[model samples]
Structure formats: structure tokens, C-alpha cells
Target: MTAKVLNIIKILQPVVIMVVVQISLAGVNILSKLASIDGMSSSILVAYRLLFAAASTVPLAFYMDRTIKPRPMLTWTVIGQAFLCGLLGGSLLLNMYMQSLVLTSVTFVAAMSNLLPVITFILAICFRLEKVLLTKAPGSMKIVGTILGIGGAMLMTFYKGIEIKLWSTNIQLYAHESTSTNKQDRVLGTLIALGSCLSFATWLIVQAKLSKIYPNPYSTTAMMNVMGSLQAILFALFADHDWQHWKLGWDIRLVTVSVSGMIGSGLMVALMAWCNRTKGPLFVSIFSPVCLVVVTLVGTLILGDKLYLGSVLGSIVIVLGLYAVVWAKSKEKESIQCIEEKEQGIV
Candidate 1:
């Protein structure tokens, strides 16, 4: 029974990792909502999250590896690179994500999030980290999937302008209140999201190399958290943020920050690395839309937000596109395995 359970767990790792990612995101939203009530600035909130994650994780990493002296030289540089990636991706976009929640519809934000894979794909191509041979079905599917997903995201964003109905002026009919607000929010939010994609792509590129050099996920995560903690602190200080305005009266503050720090940053990062190893980066990313769907439900029902027709339709298109890409990859992988089996049989 024990052996059978262990085998089952081995098979279930990918599902488990995806669940971790989804729960982590849901936790982030819960925390964001709670933290906002405290009137905490986005930067400060990000700092606190990083601080808590770093504080908690450092000990775990040390305790796990007590037998071996921590190799500073081997992991520090990789950690620093991850830090820079997080600084660009996490620090910039986390603030943007916070700002977006105040201005945009959760559905719109989530739908647009589908663009991360496309953005990452493009960056991967540019960085020469990913290559697709047009003739290869899998590669073609990946490229097509990236395009479809991005196209769907764009449709979701731009479709509002296509209809100038009474609801268009209804302020809450769409995601953001006004065009100017939407534009400003999207301009910053999308940019931040794109930066997030870049950081993520950087992880795909850098971590692949790091894993080749050193395969310790715990150490890698802990050291990167340390650097992220430092960078977040510095950014907060340099931003001239005045903490006097902090009003922690709300009972939800601690709960939210606790969820965000522990689940979002802490557990998710560790699971992400594990998932990437087991499921391939693209495979791990395919399920992100699932989280968006959850967020949309919470946003519309609990938050009392209106869902526009175009936003709904566009989201569907984006999901279809995302699935199409994944399907293509799956088909391609099966074909490769078949040929490998044939070769083994011939031998």
C-alpha cells in the first residue's frame, strides 16, 4: 500500500503542482483584497510579502541542508540572477497588479494574463532560448498557440471600443471605468505583466542552466528570496514611501498578508520550480487560465463587478487558443514516442 501510494504520488506530481499554482494565485487575490483595506502602498505590501517569505524560507533551506556547508559561490550568482529577474518581474508587476485590481475588472485582468505565455514565447525567441521549426507540428502548434492566446487577449482588451452602447458609458459595464483610466491602467498593467513574462522567461532560460550546474531547488529558492527581499526593501526606501499613512485597523490585513506571503510567493515559487522540472515550462504554464477563471468568478459574484459580453467572449477565445496550443504539443509528443518505440522494436 505504501509503495502504491508513492507510485500514485509520482504520477500525480504535475496535477499537484498545478493545484499549488492555482491555490497560490487565489491566495494572492485574497491577500490583495485584505491588504488594500489597510491602505498599504503596493511597494510596501510587496516588501512585506517578500520579507515574510524570506524570513520563513531561509531557515527551512538551512535545516534541510545542514549536513552540507552551504555553497555560497555556486548558488549566489544564480540566486542574484533570479533576484534581478524577480526585481524586474515581481517588483514592477506586483505594484502594477495591485493598481490594476483597483481599476480593471478581474476577468479582464485575468484574460489579459493569458498573454504571458505569448510574451514569454516572444522573449524566448528573441533571447534564442526557444526555437520553433515551422515544419514541426509541435513547434508550429506552440507558435500558433502563442499567437492565438495573444490574439485572444488583444481581442478582450480592444473589443470594448468596438461597441459604443449605453453600457459602454455605464462605467462598470466593462473592466475599467473610463478609456483614459483603462488605457493608463492597461499601459502600466500590461507592461508590468509583460515584465512578469520576461522574468518568467528568464527563469526558463536561467534556471535550466542553473539546474544543469546545481539541482537544488530549495537552496535556489531561498537565496533568490533573500535577494528579492533586499531589492524590495531598497525599492521601498528609494520610493520615499511614508509609512505613517498605514492604517491596519481592518481585521483582514494579517490574514491577507499571511496568504500572499506564505502561499503566493513562498509555496508557489518552490512548486513552480518543481513543476517546470517535471512538466516542461510550457506545460506548467498552460493551466494558468484555470486560475483566471476562478478569479473572474470571485470578482464578479463577490466584488459585484459587471461582466461585459465582449470580455466574456474574448476570454473563451483565449482559452480555446491556449488549449489548441497544448493539444498540438501533446499530439507531437505522442508521435515522437511512437517512432522511438518502433526503433526499439526494430533493434
Candidate 2:
């Protein structure tokens, strides 16, 4: 009985971590939206987030990972990891995504985030980290899953069906429905969101590679945050020359940066790196849909964001796709394990 309980706990550990990560991310989304409401620059917000994340993680990394002696040859992988995670994934992705939320609804942005896993899968295949076994069950499932996920994202992007009464409280949508005033903005937001997804996917792939070279998830994530903070600050200074926008006061902006930095950047990315190291990028991305669901409900309840028919339908499709891919991966892992067992004469 004791051994069984331990086994169950081990199995459930990642699931619990993923749940916490998703919840923190969902809250960060809402907080970011609130910060944007007060005319805060997304770039500045991201800069602060990275800075805070670095400040928090650096000490922990140094203290806990003291045994990890860095070698000179590891510089290249560190550079790649820093660029991918800090500049492209952390700063650029967050800036674009937050801006997307400004123009689009939270659910819409969250729905688009489901594209991360599909994109990551494709990148993994490209990098030869994953094989495309078209004749195999795993390959077939992945293909179908990718198609379904892309279809769902497209549906959510292009189709906003008749508003659902309870959640269609967005003033922007009401104003733009007939006038089509923000159509351009919406298109731009969608494009930006796509870029964000792609950037994040690339980051995940690079992170996986980095894990093999560094083998210290906490230190690696801390370095990425530090690098990303510097990159973001440079961009923020150039983009917004007005120093007025950088002010942090006793308000939602402070809360936004604090929570976003501490939870979203610091805790979430570190946990994700650990997950990526253990389970690969696909596993890390599989939990994105969970974040989406939580964000959808939270957006509707707190922000009075619209719950479009298309969003509901697309989210369902995306979730189904996520499950299909997960099932396929599990089967693939089982088959590999069985082969290894037979080879070792343990079966």
C-alpha cells in the first residue's frame, strides 16, 4: 500500500505542477489586461517582468545549483537559450500577446495559445528530436491532431458567431460589430498573436536542447530571464522615450509586474524548463489548453469579456486535438519502453 501510494504520487506530480503553472499563467493574463487598461506599455511591462524574474531566480539558482560547474564550451548553448527564451520567447512574445489582448478578447488570445504545441511538434520534427513515422499510429495521431488544432485556431480567428448573452459584455465588440471600426486592429492583433505562438514554440525547442547541455533548469531559466530583461529594457527605451510610462506606483501596474515577473516569468518558466527537460517540449505545451480554459472562464467572469460561439467551438476542438496528440505520445513511449525491457530480458 505504501509503495502504491508513492507510485501514484510520482505519476501525479507533473500533473499537479502543470495545473499550478496554468493557473498562475491564467491569472497573469488577467493582470496583464488590467495593466494595459491603464495605458501601460506592454514592452515596459515585459521588461519589468523579466527583471523581477531574474532577480528572484538568480539567487535560488546560485544557491540550489551550486554544484553545477559551468564549462566554457557551454557558452554557445547558453547564448542560444538566452536569445530564444529571453528576447524572442519572453519579451517579444509577451509584448505581442499583451498587445493582442488589448485589441482582442482574452479568450481569443488564449485560444490562439493552443497553437504552441502544434508548432512545437513541427519544430521538434524539423530538428530531428521527433520522428515522423507516417506509417505508425503515433504519426497518424499527430498528423490528425495538428490538423484539428490548426483548424480550431483558424475557426476562432475568423468566425465570431452571434454573441452569447451572458459573456458578450465587451464594449469594443459592441461598438465595432456594425461599424467594423477595429477590423484592422483585430487582424493585426491576430497576426501578432501568431508571431507570439511561433516565438514561444521556437523557445520551447531551443529550451529542450539547452537542457541537455546545461542540465540545470533553475540556473538556465534564471540566465534566460536576465538576458531577456536586458533585451527588453533596450527595446523599451528605444520604443518609448517617454520616461513617464516607466513609473511604478501603488496600483494595478505594480501588481501586474510583480505577479507577472514572480509567477509568470520566474516560477512558470522555471517549471516549464524542468518539464521540458524531463518530458520534452510537447509535454510542456500540452498544458497550454488548460491555461486557455482557465483564462476563458476567468475572462468571462471578471473582465466581462465575450464568450463567442466560435471561441467555445474552437476551444473544444483544440482540446480534443491536445488529447489525441497526448495519447499518441503515450503509446509511443510505452512501445519504446517495452522494446527496451525485452532487450534487457526484463519483460
Maximum-TM-score candidate: 2
- What candidate 2 gets wrong by more than 4 Å, as runs, is 67-76, 167-181, 342-347
Predictions in order: lDDT = 0.65, 0.81
TM-score of each: 0.81, 0.89
Candidate 2 residue lDDT tens string, 208-309: 778887888888888888888998899889889999899999999999998899889997889888888887777777888778878777666556676778
Clashing pairs in 2: none
lDDT of 1 by residue, 1-347 (tens): 69999999888878877866875686587457545544567777777777777777678777866676555456576656666645653565566666665456455666766665666667778879666778977788887777777777666655654432222222222233222235666556555555555566666656555545556666666766677778877887777457664334545665665667666767677677667665676777777787787876665554545566667777777777777766866787797789999989953
Worst 10 residues of 2 by lDDT: 172-181
Model 1, 158: alpha-carbon shift in Å?
Answer: 1.7
